[model samples]
Target: MYTPAAFRQDDLGELHRQILACRLATVVSQGPSGLQASHLPLLLEPGEGQFGTLYGHFARTNPQWRDLAEGAEALVIFQGPEAYISPSWYPAKAEHGKVVPTWNYIAVHAQGRAEVFEDGKRLLQLVSRLSDHHEAGRAQPWAVNEAPREYLDAMLRAIVGFALPIEHLQGKWKLGQNRSAADQAGVRAGLAASLDPRDRELAARISADHSAEAAP
Candidate 1:
């Protein structure tokens, strides 16, 4: 993450919030063969370690977990709201025609050595917690115990759980902070006018970041 000073996000709480908001993460690790990546929905334990701990599972057939079992450090990426910002949205484009197109997004990177396990009890608990967290907002939330005991046990055996206590966490919020206030406002206005929900989300993030910056 090559973050400029203006885009750097160092607040631990905010970083954890982003991770929670974007539960699915890209886990990258180096194995005996080479680099491998896995997309998994990770649960964050915010108070577990200096930064925090991440809990997730990989399919038993997935070789990436084998790498983690052998002590490979992992890099987990949590990507948040993002949108394409046209140069036309910047007021400076009209003033000096110097602006170029850019992307506005938020992301967090967590790095640490991962601890892998296949114990059925721990795996059951991990899956249950992960399920409950995601299902909390549903009208008819499901639970692991709802399924037949044998089926649930078989499902749990098909995956391997891992815990990574984050040693280093970095967040990057590239929401046009380098641009002039007028340009940022223009971007917000342009994005808010779009029908795409993602663009509107980015607009809201920009507004929030700007308000935080202007706050006393």
Candidate 2:
């Protein structure tokens, strides 16, 4: 991620919050065939290391898991709120017509050593945890043990679990951070009035950043 100082997001807690909110990550790895990427919902273990550890499972039929090695490098990308910024939202555009359209978004990149495992017990635990996390908000939450024992066992056997202990993490948040305060306010106002949910979310994030900057 190419992040300017003004747009860099280095707060570990904030990064974790975004990652959890995003839920899904793009896991990328390199192998003899070529670079492969898989989209998976991952759980982050904050206390696993200096950065953290990522846990997720892959379908047994997914060949992307075959690229994982004990100590091989892996990249996981977590994307948060993103929106298009129109030049009309910039105050400078009216001042001197120097503004151009751009994009505003947040993303976190986690690099780590990949480790793949296939223990049935571990797979069961992984599936249980993943289900718990995603189903918590449902009125009738589902559980791994909700199905028949033989069926659950067969389902678990069709997947493989993996862990990536994070070695490096980088975050980029381009929410009009490089623009003047007036311009940022203008962008926020424009985004707030838009009908797109993503634009409203980007506006809220920008407002939060402003509040954080204003804090003593």
Candidate 3:
């Protein structure tokens, strides 16, 4: 990702937080046919490698896994809160009429060579962990063993698991950091008052980023 100095996010903890908050990710790899992309919910093991390791699966019928089996490097993209920024929200628009419309968003990219696996025992464990992670907030969390043994085994066999130890990690938080403080405050006020919940989320991120910058 091309990120300006003001928008660059290099903190490891912050990168992990953004990745975890955005559950679903786009995994892209080069295949025999061409570049292929798969949307999957990935689990992050933050302590696994220099950066971290990602765990996820693909349906056995999906050809993307076959591409990954070739040892080609993969890129995983995690997108967080994003919103459109109107030029009208900038105080500079009124002062000099120089501001133009843009977008504010947060995103993280992870790259590594993927390792595919088919071991039934490992598959079972991966499914169980994935289920538990997403179900933890439910009133009654579900487990993999709840289903019939044969059925669960069959379901597991239909999917292929992969591990990618992140070799490179990059985060971009474009929340109008290049704008003047007054203009940023104008954006915050405008977004915070909007009806869209996503706009409100972006406004909150702007506020948080401002606070972080102001901190000594």
Whole-model lDDT, candidate 2?
Answer: 0.87
Tens digit of lDDT per residue, candidate 3, span 1-216? 999888999999999999999979999999787999999999999999999999999999999999889888899999999999999988778888977899999999999998999999999999999999999999999988899999999998899999999999999999888777877888899999999999999888886448323211
* Candidate 1 C-alpha error for residue 20, in Å: 0.2
Q: List model 1 lDDT by residue over 1-216, tens digit each.
A: 898778999999999999999968999999898999999999999999999999999999999999999999999999999999999998887888987888899999999999999999999999999999999989999998899999999999899999999999999999887777788899999999999999999998886448323211
- List residue ranges in candidate 3 displaced over 4 A: 208-216
For residue 139, model 1's alpha carbon misses the true position, in angstroms, by 1.0
**Candidate 1, which segments miss by more than 4 Å at Cα?**
208-216
Better candidate by TM-score, 1 or 2: 1
lDDT of 3 at 209: 43
Instruction: For model 2, give the RMSD to the true fold.
Output: 2.9
| Candidate 1 local distance difference test against the native | 0.91
| Steric clashes per prediction | 0, 0, 0
**How close is every model to the real structure, measured as TM-score?**
0.95, 0.94, 0.96
